[model samples]
Target: MSSSTQHLLVATAALGAVAWLVGVAVITIGIARARNAGDPDATVARARRMRTVTLALTVPGAILVAAAGGWYVLGRDLSIDPNWWIGTALATWLVTTFGSTFGRARQLSLAADRAGEHGTDDEDAQWRIRRVDLIARGELLLLVVAVVVVVLQPTAPL
Candidate 1:
C-alpha cells in the first residue's frame, strides 16, 4: 500500500481508539454521578441500557476486525493488523464500560418515570441526556474513523 493510505488507516484506528477511551471515561463519570444522586433504581436502569448497547456493538466490531485481518493476510502492505486490533479493543471497551453504565441508567430512568405522572426533575433528565450525548459523540467518532478506513482501502473501486 502507498504510505499515504497506510497512514490514513493507522490514523483512523488511532482516532477510533481514542474516541472509545474518552467515551468510557465519560460514561464512568456519569455512573459516579448517578450513584451520588439519591436514586438507586435510576442508576440501575441506566447501567442496563448501556450494557445492551455495548453488547450490540461487539458483533459489528468483530466482523470489522476479521475483515481487517483478512486484508492484512492478502499482502496488501497495510499494517491494518495493528489497526484492526486497536479497533477491536476500542469496541471491547465500549461493551465493558457501557455495560457497567447500563444498569445504572435503566434504574435512573425508571425512578424518574415513577417520580411523577407528568414530569421529572430537570436535573435528572439533563443528566441522562448528557450521558447519551457523550455516547453518541463517541459513536460518531468511531464511524468517522471507519469511513476513513474504507476510503483508504487499497483496492480500486471498479
Candidate 2:
C-alpha cells in the first residue's frame, strides 16, 4: 500500500478503537441504568444490545488493525512474523465476543425468568454483577493486546 494509504488506515484504525471504547462506555451506562430502573425486561434487552454493539465496534476495529498491520509489513518490506500479533488480536476478539455474550445471556435469561417480580433478588443481582465483571475483564484484555500491537509494531520507514 502507498504511504498515504497506510496513514489513512492507521487513522481509521485509531478511530475505530476509540469508537469501540465509547460503545463500551455506553453499554456500561446502559447496564447501570437498567439496574437502577429495576426493569428486568429493559435490562435484558439492554444487555443483549450491549453485546451486539460491542461486536459492532470490535469486529471492524480488528479488521482495520489487521489491514494496517498487513500494510505495515508490505510497505516496510520487512520479514514480519505476524503470527503472535495476529493470534493475540484474534484471541482478544474471540474472547470478547464469546465471553460478553455468554455472560450477558446468563444475566438476561435470569432476569427474564424472574420478571414481574417484586424486588431484585440476591442471586439475580449477583449474576448481573458477575456478568459485568467478566465483560470488563475481557475488554481490558482486548485493550491491552491492542495497545501492545500498536506500540510494538515495527514502524521503519518504507
lDDT of 2 by residue, 1-158 (tens): 67788778668767766665566566667777776787655665666666666567655655565566556656756453544554555566567656663345455445544543533444664366446745765675576666677557544333
Off by over 4 Å in 1: 52-158
TM-score of 2: 0.56
- Which window of ten consecutive residues has the lowest lDDT sum in model 1? 54-63
Local distance difference test scores for all models: 0.48, 0.59
Candidate 1 lDDT over 13-107, as tens digits, reads: 44444444444444556555765685755554554554444434433343444444344334464343544643544454455435433344454
After TM-score superposition, the amount by which residue 15's alpha carbon in candidate 2 deviates from its true location, in angstroms, is 2.3
Candidate 1 lDDT for residue 113? 60
Best candidate per TM-score, number? Answer: 2
Clashes of each: 24, 0
